[model samples]
Target: MLSISSTRQRQPFTVLILICLLLLLPTSLPFLLPPPTTRPSLPTLRSPPRRSPPLPPSSSSSSSSTSLSSSPLDPLLSLSTLASVILIHELGHYLAARTLNIKVSEFSIGFGPKLFSFTRSIINNKMNGEEENIEYSLRVLPIGGYVKFPENYNSSLVMEEELKGREKFKEKLNVEKNEKGILGMFEWLNEEEEGVVKKKVKSGSKPKITTPPKEIEYYTDPNLLQNRRPRDRFIVLSAGVVFNFLLAFILYFGSVLFGPGLLKTEINRGVLVTSEPIPYSPSSGILHKGDVISSFNGVNLLKLPSDVNVIEKEISEIIKTIKSTETGNEIEIGRGSERITIKPSLAVGRSYPTIGVSLSPNFSGVSKIKTRNVFEAVKLSVQEVCKVTKSTTKGLASFFESILPKFGGGGGGGGGSISGPIGVIKLGSDVIGQKDWSALINFAAAISINLGVVNALPLPSLDGGQLGFVVLEKVRREKIEQRTMDDVNAIALFGILILSVGTVFSDTMRLFGK
Candidate 1:
């Protein structure tokens, strides 16, 4: 039977051998390829409030102050740095006045009653007008400052109005028709003189006495602000904004060249302690305050793999994973010389992972910047001005949109409230303590930008507001009625006074947590 069996029909011995070889291959495969090495367990995420350390004091290098993230709220306020922010804005006005040879009577640093002040000089009587020279002083309010230019009291446009009205009267009967404007303009001037009427002689009892009236001098100077061309006046009026933007740039450049500049590179490349836990969290303990995070979830945050060509793409992926991850899922992280697996706990109210710690980026050579070069400093200064103006517009737009409502007063809840000087000081101190100079520099730039923007708004009391009037005159190709514009300005001024009062009230209300 074995000799006659076909090739397809296997013998029992051959079938048994084939079965033995198949079984042996499974045991020998391990010798060809070894098993993967074991990975170490990571620290769990956890921390308690009592275990948190007290906040460290800030360190200011020179008078130029920049701080690390002292508080989340600090970066949100650009208006609170009154000295560096608001004072510099006023400097713009003063310089602009000087540039156009316009006389500035007073410069007030604050809005309310005087805190302390002194006049730069005694009265000069430029126009010899009834208005005496004002001795401007600093006010208790530290929010803003102003420059008083000559003719600001009357606003040059006002003088032209009186002259035009009188001239129209002179031409009414002889040269033109219906050109006298209002019929009763003469009544306004003559009402005061009516008191000194000459006595008329009665036919029998009184002799005619027409004594010449004593000459009353009205202060007039044609060469001053009244005589300046609208274009020139506009230049002077617009100069303050120009100077404010300029100063903003200079400060910004100084901050960049001398202080910490914006970090253009990835944070992992910089000097930082990634292990500090985020505040008021439960995971603070499982994560130590000193350990540096080398990688997150088995992927190194330092160098994203070659397949991840762009850093932003990797970051997007990481964020997506963080958002999708569930609480019971284990997080694989690399610490200094150790691999740790942590089971992420769900944070009560957030969509993101709550490791309860914030990491600082490493920055080298922060203490080595210098702002001594004249030309380079000036160039950087200019760039900064442009940068700040652009940034201010962008940031404020978000708040106005109610996208994240933070500041107080709004159709939305975002107008959290205005943070005054106390808030800014607290922010400054907090940042300095954290040693985050880059943040501080950016903050200063932001404030300067805000100053420039607010000053440039076309409001009656602001520099831009006055500029708007000048533009109006240019379009009309003639001077507008000063009284009309002045009246409009007066209303505007009142509105501003009310706004100031509101701001004070708002600040007070916020202090008491109302």
Candidate 2:
């Protein structure tokens, strides 16, 4: 029922161009944007380092068992997983609509031409008596999906059809009543007594009840979504995001309870210096590739609370010490069995002060551990989802905050970076190459949460945007003009398409840069 206009149909080419621009723009950002005129002279603390690339196994046997060579199919697997996530999102909308007895026109995965399609008649218990046909379809493009509701639900043509259907239902009821004879007559009389049917009699004469009611009213139509209550509309609009979150939680719980289990990184000793510092850097002569830093300026790094992951806490403390360094700074290191202390003179007033060395937790190894029971799995999964949701919300808020200023010619948007579909596929491929299947599951869960968070944003063309309109209608107590709403949605959709292209392009450039 939702038709694409000729102008809208030609947007794919424009989208392609945008994608190309996005892909190429990041690589050219240095030349396109002017350098900052000022810089911070003081050292600042930052979050812990991102996970390092997976290390090669030490032995050939370990390599064969723990790692896999990169394959051509890696991208395909990643794409499939993404499609599955999108499909589940659409399904959520479909289920929610059906639950509310709202008629849905089509449920589709992907865009463009239909690869496959079928229609099924679903019987709604509240339909006041019949089935509505819904089309399920798969389209050629694997980019995204949608659940379509009839665009002209309130049109005269639709009202006419509904009238005919109601007439037929009334006839069916009359036939059943006639078949029941005397009992049906009593049922009709009871209906008249209860005000279900209007009755009239001459002053003193007894009223005569017909076998069938003279009129059948109060037959509510629950088929049109727009005609539903605001609460129902909100539920339908928000169901996709809810489903995405639920899927992520399920994946996390399964990974912890039934799959390869959740991964736990055991920290051993202190922070391992990943690479030696540059020749002229502050840590040049003071640190080496294998040095394990045990303490910073007399603060013991290994002493941590029982309930915390020491790696993040230790790294935070180390960074704090380095940022707060004054005239003298000392680091205690463990080299084999020898305890060595070194004082490195860090350069001041050079943006962020650093020891100029790559560092990570001195991890003994990674191990898979499962929850003791289903209850534990549920608890852990909920915690993981909550943690991820919190971090994602902060990250999204920070990204927008950073980029918004840049839009007005202000600086510092460089920190608000993002990746699109291509980036996700590439990340999945890397996980597959590492053959850390458990990590892959966790990655999928994180992606699922990310999808939910993005959709939940109050941005145009997203689910949240539609929800906003619904809320506005409720507050105003009047429906927004259908044409106006359509135009807004069309414009928003075009903008999003352009953005997606750019994101894809940017991600491609990043992939190649790596």
TM-score leader: 2
lDDT of 2 at 280: 81
Q: Give candidate 2's TM-score.
A: 0.62
Q: Report the lDDT tens digits of candidate 1 across residue range 1-514.
A: 0000111121211111112222322111000000000001112222211122222233553334544444555533333443546566556556655555546666776555789988765344554433334456787655555565444233334345556766665665234224433332223335444322212112233322132322323235442443467877777666656665666566556665665443222122311234565555544555566454567676766564322123334444544565566877876667655676755555768645655554433222112234556677677566556554554454344324442332354334222123333333433444434445554554455545555675566776556677787888888988665445556665765564443343334434644566
After the best TM-score superposition of candidate 1, give how far the Cα of residue 479 lies from its true spot, in angstroms: 2.0
Cα displacement (angstroms), candidate 2, residue 23, comes to 11
Q: Would you list the C-alpha lDDT of every candidate in the order shown?
A: 0.46, 0.60
In model 2, residue pairs whose N, Cα or C atoms come closer than 3 Å (at least 3 residues apart or on different chains), thus clashing, are 19-501, 22-506, 23-505, 23-506
Supply the TM-score for candidate 1: 0.46
List, residue by residue over 1-514, the lDDT tens digit for candidate 2. Answer: 1222222122222123223333443221110000000000111112223343243233442344434456899877866666677667777888998888888877776776889999998776678667788888887766446677764333444446556777875676577568874234335345546343333332444445333322312224556666678899899888988998999899879977876666554445556677778678777886777666666555565554322234544665576566555646565655544566655455555544567776666654455657659999999889878876765665566456666776687653323235666676666676666565666676677777777777776754567877888899999999775545656767876665544555566666777883
Error of model 2, residue 76, in angstroms:
1.2
Q: Which parts of model 2 have CA positions greater than 4 angstroms off? A: 1-70, 123-125, 142-144, 153-222, 266-365, 413-417, 490-506
For all predicted structures, in order, the TM-scores are: 0.46, 0.62
